[model samples]
Target: MTTICVDAMGGDERPEVVLEGIAAALAADPELEVLVAGDEGVVGPFAESHERARALVTTEVIGMGEHPAEAVRAKRDSSIVRGCAAVRAGEADGFFSAGSTGAIFTAATLGVGRIRGIRRPALATALPGLDGHRTIALDLGANADARPEMLVQFAHMGRAYAKVVLGVEDARVGLLSNGTEDAKGSELAVSYHEALAAAGCGFAGNAEGTDLLLGSFDVIVCDGFTGNVALKSMEGTAKYLVKQIKAAAGESKRSAVGALLFKPALKRVAAELSGDEYGGAVLLGLKAPVFIGHGATSATAVAKGTAACAAAVRGGLVDGIAQALADAS
Candidate 1:
């Protein structure tokens, strides 16, 4: 059975949405098991009633605003910490949290630990693309500051994740830069461009921001700061476009009537554009899969992230990264 440790008190919508997501995940995957960590008062009855669930009662909760490292050190029994501990202790195969990104990243790195020969683990997500394409991007928010060599590692890691999870046979890696030309981009990007190319980890050269969804590159690598900014910008732009479309659709009775025919397609596109397509970002270069969802994630996202984690575990994500890193070295 593939087991995942869940942080029940992690998200904005506490135990309720978390429980609902767990229920949905359990219903969907018969062989999946969960080690839910949260307050006894909240998670006790759910664990007792569910056949595949067990609760790890926690007295402390690391609030979203609290300092991640401090909370992790002080609140040893926090749900996030306990969940990572569960993974570290071999009680669970993966960790899933819709909590503070800092907290989950800190706890997972300090607790469950990084894979061998990895300097810094990165956050990656397969951005859904047009024409049935998918491009994987890395260092979403794990490390804001990274050296050129780290970009090399991110390239290899992104390539491996795309190959294993996205089923890309020969993942092409791209360095996110201002222009496709090697001479373009900041000093770091130029240096990373050179280092990534020399690393020989399928570096396909520089890619512009517009190329993210174009599927020209299978993997996009960058520092966490840049990647995170790019992701949020894309999300904001999508929301704006959706809002405008809705406004346009309602401007007149004739248009609204026409919109009725395409509402279903619009909804699907909105869902895809909302950045909820993947539900969570996969933290690569770790010993186990640690899925970090948005703090305000919905029940759908919770379920999707949990299911994705289970799939990653079954797909040998850890083994794939290890093999990729070994080969790169």
Candidate 2:
């Protein structure tokens, strides 16, 4: 059985949602083995009560809200650290958490470490654009700032991730900017675009925020600061649009009838727009696969994230990344 480690105590909702996710994951993958690291007393009972959770899980509870590094050093018992340790020790094939992004990144960097020659790890998230095209964006807050060289590295990393994970061959990489012209972006974007172009990457010119939904490129590379802002903006806009649609539907009987008539189709469309439907973002460039789920993730979302991690392991993503970096170096 492929083993997966989960930070059972992490998340805005804490043990309840995390536990719910774990239980749902176990239910979906009967052969999957889970190592839950959190407060044992709390998580054990929850896991035991669920047949799939109990049958498939092993437990080790750690403290909640402890400083990440200190907890990693001192609280050999903190959930995030323990989960990373499990993956590092080969007890788990991958790690999943809806925990503090800072803690997860810190613990993983220290415990599991980066792939050879990778300067730093990056967070990669796939956002659905127009035309059923999914655009993958990288450095989504892993490294708030990046060098031109780092952006070049991100291109290679994003390319490989899109290829293996998203099954997109000949993935196109774009430099995010305010305009399509080479002169339109910041100094870094212009320099990086030139560097990427020269580096033999499939660099598809500049893509503005407006082009984000146009699917102009398969991968978009930017420093985390820009990427994070873009991500939040998109998420907020999506939420607002959904709220507006619901409100509009509730305004009159005619709208209510229309909502019922199109409810199934609307549900399908909503699922596609939801961030969780893409599973979760991958913490690429690490030695082992790590998926960071949304803090408000439901059981289905967590289960899907776990399955994505399993696919990463089976597809040799970590090893592929190491080789790609080594070749580029």
Candidate 3:
């Protein structure tokens, strides 16, 4: 049986929402087992109620505002740390946490460790394109300022994500830039473009910001600072456009009728744009699969994230990365 260790007290919503989500996940997958990690007072009852769950009883919690490295080192018994330790100790096949991104990264990297040759582990997620194709983007917030060589490594890892997770063989890779031309970017992008082409890791030309949703490339590579900015901008724009459309439609009876006619389609669009669709981002280059969800996650999102972690375990995501890096070397 595949088991996933969950941080039941990690997110802003805490134990209640986490427990509800876990119930949904357990009901959906009979073969799946959960090892709940949190304070005994918070996680005890839930574990008692569910036959498939076992509580780890962590005493500490890493706050959203705490420094990642410091919190991880200081709070050895934090839910985040213990969860990662569970994965490393073979108690769980994978892990899921809707916790502080920084804490999750620090704990997972230090506790579970990275693949032997990987210089840096990146956060990779599949964002849906306008054409309904999903493109894998890396360093979503892992390393704010990465070196050129790190971007090259991100390219390799991102390709593995697309191939195994998204089922895209021979996925094309691109450097995120201001223009499609190889010469039209900052020093980092320029260096990445030249190095990626030489590395022969499915190098496509440079990708403009629009290419992220336009499906112009199968994988878009960037430093965490730039990628986080671009991702937030896209998210804000989508929210703004939807709000405007709904407001305009509600202003008149005729428009309301039109909105009623397209309500289902609108919901489909919203779900597609929501980052919760695929659960959360995967911390690539680690020894095992560890998914990091949004701070404000819903029960549905938690369930989806749990399923995703299980999928990664069954899909051999870590083994796939090791083999890919070996082949590249």
- Which runs in model 2 stand beyond 4 Å of their true positions? 46-76
Please write out the lDDT profile of model 1 over residues 211-276, one tens digit for every residue: 888757999999999999999999898889888988999999988988889899988887775555
TM-score each candidate.
0.96, 0.89, 0.95
- Which scores greater on TM-score, model 1 or model 2? 1
Q: Which candidate is the best by TM-score?
A: 1
Poorest 10 consecutive residues by lDDT, candidate 3 = 270-279
Whole-structure CA lDDT of model 3: 0.88
Clashing pairs in 2: 38-61, 38-62, 62-77
Pairs in steric clash, model 1 = none
Cα shift from native, residue 62, model 1 (Å):
2.0
Model 3 per-residue lDDT tens digits across residues 235-292: 8998898899999999999999999899899988877777778878889999999998
TM-score of 3: 0.95
Candidate 1: stretches off by over 4 Å: none
Error of 3 at 71 (Å): 1.8
